[model samples]
Target chain A: MRETLRYVASRLATTFLIVLGAMILLFALSALVPGDPATALLGPAATPEYVQRFIQEMGLDQPWYRRLFSFMGNVFVGNLGTDVLSGQPVTRIIANVLPYTFILTFSSIGLAVAFGVPLGCYAATHRGSLLDHLLAFVSVAFIAIPSFVIAIFLLLIFAIWLDWLPVMGAGEAGNWFDQAQRLILPTIALSVGWIGFIARLVRSSMLETMGENFIRLSRAYGLSNRLITYKYALKNACIPTLAVLGMGVGRLLGGAVLVEIVFSRPGLGRLMFDAISTRNFPVLQGTVLVVVLIFVLTNLLVDLSYAAIDPRIRRQGSR
Target chain B: MNPDLPMITIRNLKLDARTEHGPAHILRGIDLEFGRGRIVGVVGESGSGKSTLVSCLLRLLPSNIERLEGEILFDGIDLLKLSPSDMNDWRGRKIAMVFQDPMTALNPLFTINTHLRDVLKRRFPQISAREARERSLAMLTKVGISDASVRLDAYPHQLSGGMRQRIVIAMALLVEPDLLLADEPTTALDATVEAQIVDLFDQLRQDFSGSIVFISHHLGLVAELCDDLCVMYGGTIVETGPVAEVLARPRHPYTRALLDCEIEDDHGGRLATIPGEVPSATWAMDACIFASRCAHVADICRRGPTVLETVAIGHKAACKRSREVLP
Candidate 1:
């Protein structure tokens, strides 16, 4: 128990450092944006006097370190400052956009795990069979194509050609079915890479675990094939897959940006893209912070889940 | 003695294992029988097909491997003819196995109780979880695990190597199998622990009516413990008899060579060893498989396959000149 607590505490510290590092990188990158910050925010219609007044009012007149410090402080207090372009609080804009991205990321991962694990199990059990070869080919194909290309192809086939699903938006505001229908294409595009990678991972790991002594013992005891495969082999196989999934979260978030842009979904990806073009520094920084935070937290959850999945790990942790 | 009434009989069992290269001859028409409540020791060096023989008995060979011919008669049922599902029912329940490496034999993820419960549940599906737990506790205690109740919740990694082997033995015996195939169960254990485990096996034999086929390379253990002994060389039994008789007067050159290899603590002499690699089963052998290493090799011994023939009362040796071969 103490070991688990210590592990959690250390992980939480690592998470903090990662998020801080990400914020510093985001701030440095934003500062390197070409053109005067005040001019970019105020636009061509603003005179010199108006630009200076806007710069002073928005704390752009302060030193870079001071601005960074205050931005960090504001972030801790849940106040992400205002978007200079629309004069809206960055937090409000993020709050409005997060649900869409959340739905996309979670659903994509859900689909990935749902399909990847079974496909991997099937491929492993049916090694050298026709079905195994087919799954291997399909996984390779999915992995070979980039997410954006998959998104475009899915849009082309399902939306443009068949008119089966919407090409843009997060569907009607209150209608769950409409939202689910709209999410289908983007979700597939986002999840395809994970499915391929995870399936391959699970297949190799399952094969390795099946060769383990415990598996042989289980077979010797005449355990049912289903019990042996799912209970014994799959559990050992899932450890590596879980670790991959944990690391995959950050990649998934990055992948979500392209998927969201392609689908024209009103999510953080779309919001950040607009913020980048408009030089809305606060919105860009805040969106990046949220992504970083999610990535770190997901990793921590993965580490904790390891203890739950394998009691040996739990015992080690307690020790 | 009613020699016709054997608990298990293996007749003309031939296994042709499909290797990456092609089919390799594994077992060359093996015939063995064990009486009820007997401890039979199958002793052989590596690559002699001792493990393969037991795997065939359990029908646990990999899919690629094919059994060319065999009749494994147990309680009037042919194990070779049973469907995979029926075989599953027989495994663990009727015929259990204890493996070599105690460290890796039990699943690391599962607790002792869970491992026991899984085996118990298979046999007694209608038993409640609490009753299963009770049985598991009782079995753990029976296997000589102290603090049995607490040990039930412990993972395999939490226990010492000897403890883990005990747990594995307990699990295999939990269902009270009619036949136990222990494939070098003490090979991975230290000498002290090996002695302890062997003692436990001896004790368990008295309480359980099941027969045990103890496969090992250790001649001392086999000679000390086994009632019946089969000495294998290159996938065929070179000698078989009552353990005491075989240990006293081995009739095959290979068996004599093996017995000579076991050094006594008091003997301050150079250790004996048979020279020559075990012939690959993939290669066609028209003569004695051990002819290359045999000091007694003669022209006829190298010209044709030798068959097991009675050289004494209830003792057999598979050598053409068994009468000439001396211990």
Candidate 2:
């Protein structure tokens, strides 16, 4: 328990460093986007006096270091600055957008795990049979197709042709069915590849684990293949899956940007994309920082999960 | 002894395994039998097709390696003809197999208890989870594992090599199998542990009344542990006899060479040895398989199919010149 606390403490420190680094990078990158935010906000024809006054009022008159310091200060105090256009705090915009992305990410992951694990088990157990080959082929096909291509294909079939679901929406319809319908295409598009990726990973790992002494030992005890697959192979099979899934999380988020665009959902991806074109410095920078924070936290979660799943990890961590 | 009663019969067990070239002769015309409760040892150097022979018995050979024509009868049931689902049932219940490398055999992610319970659950459908747990603990105890109940929660990585082997032994003995097929079970273990395991197997057989087909490259272990012994070469048995007789007076030239290579504890004035590498089964051979290595080369050996004859009671050797080869 004490070891867990200490590990968490060290991770917290690392997370703090990550937050700082993310903020700095976002600030620099946002500043270097080629066009000035002030210019974009003013738009083409403005008198010198009005431009200078607008710039000063917006705190563009301040030194780079000074602006950065205040930005960092506001961030530390849990106050990300407001969006210049909406007159809404960056935190509020993010809080509203985040849930859409979060739900999609979580739902897609749930789908992948539910489908991938059993398929993996089946393929590994069958190995060289027709079922194994067919499953492998399907998984490979899903993984090979681009996510947008999948999104468009799913959109074409599920939305355009069938008319079973909406093509695009920001969950604006308020009805749960409408919101869920909007999610289906994007979620499946994002998740289909992950299903393949995770299943392939789980299968190979399961194959390896199945060869392991304990598995053989289990069989020698007259254990049924099903019990051994679930209780032995599945648990042993999780480490590689966890690794692939942890890496997949970032891809899922990045993939969501394109999916969110096609579906027109208001997510951090869409928010940041709009912010980029408008040169809305605060929103763009805030989104980048949150993404980094999410990434670092995800990594920490991976570590914690690793410890939870394997006793060898807990023992190593404590030592 | 009924002398004629072969408890487990293997008739014309011909296995032609696939290779890069194509079907390699794995087992050719193997007709052997094991008496009830007898310890049969299969000894050969690496690549002698000893491992392949046991794997065939279990139907555990890798998918590509096909058993062409064979009948493996365990009591009255034709094992080779059983379905995969039925094979799973037969395995560990009727015929249990233990392998080399205790490290690789047990699944790493699970606790010993989970592994034990899972196996028991398969064989005993009516066994309650609690009963499985109880049975697992009892089995562990039978294998001489102390604090059996406490050890269940422990993972494979947590246990010593000796302990792991014991656990595997405990697992194999759970249903009290009619036959136990152990393939190089102690080869990966340290010498001391190997001795302990061999001794444990002896004790286990006494209690369990299960016959064992022990396969290994270590002829010493086989000589010490087995009652009946077979020496395989080029995917076929070159010689077989009562262990003491075979060790004392080998008939097949291949067997002689194998025994000749045994490391002596004290070199008299010179170390004794043999000169040859085991020939690959994939390489087509039209002569006596041991002709390439045998010191006594004859023109008759170059002819196909080295025939086996009962040179002595309960002793057989597959060689054209078996009469001259033996002392």
Candidate 3:
């Protein structure tokens, strides 16, 4: 238990450094882009004295290095700084939209796992059967086509033509059931490419597990087909499949940007897109930092999962 | 005669498998009657269909196997005719198999109790998990696992090779199967452990009252462990008899050559190898399976399959030239 905690703590420290680096990058890009924040904030028709005073108040008058340090210092002190447009704290904007991003990422991942594992196991067991060939063909086909194309196609069929689900806005009239209905099309669209990618991993892992001597022994022990496949084969296959799942969390979170734009949901992806379009520096910077932080934390969790999947990882440092 | 029957009656069994290349004949007509309470050691070279034959008895062949004909009669009941669910019940209770490589022959993720209870729970459905654990621990001690009680929670990966095999042996015996198929059980153990496993068979036979089907490429071990011996070649039984009679005077050329190839007790002299490779199943054969390796092969040996003929009261050999080939 002591060792597990130490491992997690050190990993958390490493993740903090990574988030810090991403924030620095976002701030650097925000500053370097064409048009000064001072000119953009104070209209061109305003007096130079008024414009200069507003710039001084905004700390744009300070040297670039001093301004960057001050921003970082304020972030460290838990002050996200005020939004240039709204005069509200940037953290408030993130707090409101965070739940939607979580829902999108979690639901899409749940869908991917529910389909990928069984399909892969079936393909491995059947090998050259029709079901195996069809799964391989379709998964590879979807993987190669790109997520954006899949999103557009899903929208066309399910949202526009058939009208099975809502095309946009998390649905204005949404209780739990309505929200779930709204999520169906976009979550599937976001998950199609991921499911395809995960299926291949699941297939190979299942094949390897089935070949293990114990699975044969299980059959020899008078175990029914169901017992051997699920209890023996699936448990052995979980370690490798879980590794892929951990990394997929980050990729799915990143990929949600495209899906959010397509569906126009009020998730972080949409908020980030809107901030970019309106040139709202505080909102844009805040969203980037939040995404970066979540990405780093998720990756740390992924790294920690290696130990659970394999007892050897825990033994690695002990001896 | 009461016609009450021997324990297992394998009559004209034939199994064929299809691979990516083509259809491969695994078992050609195998006719044998193994009576109750007799240990039969099946001796052969690699790819001689020993494993394939044993796997067929359990109906554990790979899914790609194309055709299986003939009936396996376990106590006068045709095993192949039973539905799959019935077959599941027949397997652990009537027949159980312990494979080679004790190191990996048990599930690594499961505790020994998990594997034992899984089999026990099927027949003894009313037994509680706690009682199942106790029964397994007691059985583990029966197979000479020293801390059998403590090892119940340990996985296969945590145990030594010898311990794992012991656990597997215990599992097979726990169900009190009438026939136990052991396919090279000692091949993966150390020499000391091998000796122990070999010796364990003799001690086990007296107490358990079960017939053991031991499969190996070792002729010497076959002579030591088995009361009856069956020699396999080209996916067919070549020779079979009481071990002393068969080993003392090997009639079939293939059987003699296999005994001559035993190297462990050969002292410092160079070991012998059987001449020529075993023929591939895909190749068309119109002769004795071992004709290529026989030194005294006559012209008629190349004609066709040799029929089995009784040489002694419970002995048989499949060679047209058995008289000429015998030493």
Candidate 4:
């Protein structure tokens, strides 16, 4: 227990340092971009004197190091700076979009697991069969195309061509059912790639497990085929697949950005995009910081879960 | 004929399997019989089809295998004729197998109790949970596991290699199978543990009325533990005899070579290795499989697949020159 605690403490400390470094980089990189925030916020029609006045008033002309220290201090105390474009708190903007991105990421991951794990197991069990070959072909095809292409295709098929789902917005209207329906297309787009990767991972892992000595022993014991595949083989196969699934969470975040853009959902990806185009430096910094934090935290969760799933980890931890 | 049938009778069992090269003839027309309460040790070098023969008995050969001809008669029933699902019921109930590597034999995810419970439940569905626990503990104790009740909650990983093997033995015997197939069960354990497991098998024989087919590459272990010994070479049983008689006089050249290679001491002297590899089963061999490596090879020894002719009471050898070869 103590060893696991020590391990987790060390990991969390490293993640904190990384988040700190990332935030600094986000601030520095945003600052280095060749654009005056005041001029961008004021638009091309603003008089030169007024632009200069606005820059001074907003403290855009402050020394980079000084401004950085202040921003860091505020962020340390849970204060992301206010947006120059809307004059609203950056945290509030993130708060509105963060939930949608979370929903998109998690739901897609759920969808990926729902389809990927079973398909992979099926391919493994029915190796050399037509179904196995078809699954293999589908995984390779899905993996080859980028998430955005899948997003566009799904949008075209379900929204434009089929008229089965709404083409725009995360339906924050009507009932909970409507909201869930709105998410379906975006979730499918984000998950298709993940499902392919996870299924392939599961298939290969399961094949290896099926060949293991314990599986043969299980068979020798007269275990039902169902018990052997679902209980014995799948249990072992899923350990490695769990790590892959966790990694897919972070990968899904990247894909979710493209998916959100295609679906026109109010998510972190869309927020980041709008912030970048308008040069909304504060909102951009806040969004990037939140994304990094989520990535680090999820990885920590993944690491901790290893100890729970495999007792060998716990035994090693105790040692 | 005796009123009670033999526990197992394998007749002209031939097995071939697909390999990278071609179909490998693994088991070639094997004939074997053993009665209840007897321990038959199958001793052979690698690729001699000792393990393959056991797999054929269980009908658990790899998917690539093609059974050319065989009838595994267990208690007068033809196991070869049973459907796959029917075979499943008879597998753990009438017959069970213990593997060489106990670490991989038992599921790492399950507790010892769970492993025993699973077998017991299938065998005795009417038994309640409390009674099942008692039966599991009793089986563990029968296998000489100390603190059997406490050990029940432990996972396979928690136990040492020897303990795990014991658990596997316990699980196999929980259903009281009529025939137990132990494929080199002690090969993976230390010398002391191997000895202990062999002793456990002896004890198990008295307590449980079942036949055991123990396969191993260890000739000395087989000589000491088995009531009956069958020596195999190149996918054929080269000799079968009472254990004492075979050790006293091995008729087959391959069995003699295996007996010579048995380690007897920690001396720093050279250890013996059988000359040449066992013939690959993937190709057709028209000559004697052991002729290339046999020390006493002669012109007449090249005939394909020597027949097992009786050389003495209850002893048989495939060597045509057995009378001359015998010391």
Runs in model 1 with CA error above 4 Å? A1-3, A28-55, A58-65, A315-319, B1-4, B20-22, B265-267
* Pairs of residues clashing in candidate 3: none
- DockQ of predictions, in order shown: 0.71, 0.58, 0.52, 0.60
Residue runs of model 3 more than 4 Å from their true location after superposition: A1-77, A80-87, A115-167, A171-181, A192-204, A274-285, A299-319, B1-4, B19-22, B263-268, B325-327
Q: Enumerate residue pairs that collide in model 4.
A: none
Give chain A TM for each model in order.
0.91, 0.90, 0.85, 0.87
Model 1 DockQ class: medium
**Displacement of the residue A8 alpha carbon in candidate 1, Å:** 3.0
Between prediction 1 and prediction 4, the one with superior lDDT is 1
Best by TM-score: 1
TM-score of chain B of 3: 0.94
lDDT, residue B245, model 4: 95
- lDDT tens digits by residue: candidate 3, A1-319: 5666676677778888887888688778867888977677555787888888877887887888898899898888766666777788889888877877888888888899888888887888788899888888899997888676788899999888998877786865448787788888878887777777777778888889888888887777777777877777887788777777777776666557777878877778777777777777778888877777777777777678865554445445344
Model 1 residue A51 lDDT score: 88
What local lDDT does model 3 show for residue A60? 83
Question: Interface RMSD of the predictions, in order shown?
Answer: 1.3, 2.4, 2.0, 1.2
With a 3 Å backbone cut-off (N, CA, C), the pairs that clash in candidate 1 are: none
lDDT of 3 by residue, B163-192 (tens): 889888988888788899999999999989
Residue-wise C-alpha lDDT for candidate 1, range B1-327, written one tens digit per residue: 354679898898888888877778889989888788899999999989999999988887876775559799997789988888988889888899998999998888788887888788887779888999998889889889999998999888889999999999998888788899999999999999999999999888888888999999999999888899999988898999999999898898888888888874356777788887888888777999888888888999889888899888879999988777683
Instruction: Work out how many backbone clashes candidate 2 has.
Output: 11
TM-score of 3: 0.86
